[model samples]
Target: MKGRESGMPEEDYWQSFFDADGVVETLFDAAGVAGDLVEFGCGYGTFTLPAARCTRGVVTALDIEPLMVARVRQKAEAQALHNVRAEIRDFVSQGTGLVSATQSHAMIFNLLHLEQPLALLREAHRTLHCGGTVAVMHWRSDVPTPRGPSLDIRPRPEQCQAWLYAVGFTDIRQVDVQAFSPYHFALLATR
Candidate 1:
């Protein structure tokens, strides 16, 4: 549940937090998704729309917020996208379609800050297909900053790298994404 105090319209305010198109552009161009694909913390089709444009496989866009799911569904319908599907499921508590039926790849943006980054990484590892890429996007500094500088608590690139390692993610790579203004960073952790 997105607490009312969060002070943002679930999509209008929250979707603006990231340059989803830019990040998804990077992922698509980088050959990030090699198999079944999904996105964690997908809000309002921000990243989901672009991701849907690129991949031929099914793209399961997930979020914990039901309103966010509805908003994303509206956007997807407005855009006439048939490939992307929105669902409400906690990334850790529910199936991510990463491990259950089969292993899958995922792009997790701006989600790790919600809970322990290490636990998410471990779950990502468990659900992802072999050689899957888990893209983690967050801010560059944990200190007070302009972008996503929330008590909601986001991690810097260094912390993401270290956490990925701690969670047993191999071949960790951090990249600066210029798509999101105010400078957002993304880490690619593969198993």
Candidate 2:
């Protein structure tokens, strides 16, 4: 299941919507994440390359689109980031293709509005090692975002929290990420 339409913009235009480093710093720092990271959707390598550089562990970046996966791989190679492994995968339907309890952290940025958010969250939970963190960011439903799924389908902070809880994540809390991007909100949960 591909989930609802992402309403994503073109590559260059969508890349402009974020200051990749700033967003990555805020989310990763807030989560106190370390070690290997698994990203559910590596669109344009917006967060993947930066994350690979920031951590001592590998970044397994998965995307449903081959173009997106190839883009991430190109960025990683251009940046000389040997730790990033970009894969073309239908993670939404088939899961991350990573072993359970093998990753130290997971990044689910800008992807929580899927039709089966719980399925993805559970997959994240299963992949993460005990005590590992999952950092989630999504378009803020309260505000009119420049580019995101419509408010009708976007998951609010509260709704995201509930879904996280249902997936057996603990210590779930919202992070203040206004400085990173006004259009998005972040949550950190532990497995």
Candidate 3:
């Protein structure tokens, strides 16, 4: 963490992320956590904190960047959320294995636009129990943002659904919410 900057400008984008058309409502609906829930890119704990508040199990907020990890930790601490935790983890790990019996739900917003999401999705796949849920959403249309990565890698609803299907997730489909204008699709896949 030596050369790490104080904070990321990405945190500012979250100010509007929860305000997006139907995003916040969908997040609220994502309530009702049964067991351990994992958020892949839990930026600043916007969704993580709420999901934790709604659930009873541990919330593992994993991000690749150390700065992002620190940011989420700060947010969790500021809110006095005792069950949430954050860690720095690359999408791909060389070798390791451990999974618990408890089920876990997952949320991925504006995160599927990465250059390689499958590798991380595979890790997620390994960590979930049967009947676990995964929610993935990306920008509906490409909007230029210097602060964020290129969204050219985004997947359509159908594509996301198919990807989930290919990854062994059952009940894979899109959640039709009013939050999206042209409508950004969020694919829900059950483990």
Best by TM-score: 2
Mark the regions of model 3 whose C-alpha exceeds 4 Å error after superposition. Answer: 1-10, 20-32, 94-101, 142-151, 180-183
Q: Highest lDDT: give the candidate number.
A: 2
For model 1, residues 1-191, the per-residue Cα lDDT tens digits are 43222223445666666677777777556645755677777766677888877776778888877987898788778887887778988766654655542445677776667555566677778777677777887655634545464654656777778888997788888666765635477778777
Better of 1 and 2 by lDDT: 2
Candidate 2, residues 33-92, lDDT tens digits: the string is 788989998878888988987898999998888888888888888889999999988887
**Global lDDT of each candidate:** 0.69, 0.86, 0.63
Error of 2 at 130 (Å): 0.9
All candidates: CA RMSD (Å): 3.0, 1.2, 4.5
Each candidate's TM vs. the true structure?
Answer: 0.82, 0.96, 0.78
Q: Pick the winner on TM-score between candidates 1 and 2.
A: 2
Question: Per-residue lDDT for 119 in model 2?
Answer: 92
TM-score of 3: 0.78
Writing each residue's lDDT as its tens digit, candidate 3 over 1-191 gives 11122133555654554444255346436533477777776666667777777666888887677877897788778888888878776544531132643446777766765655675566667777776777786656444433333344556666677777777888776666544323355667778
Candidate 1 deviant stretches above 4 angstroms: 1-18, 95-98, 101-104, 142-145, 149-152
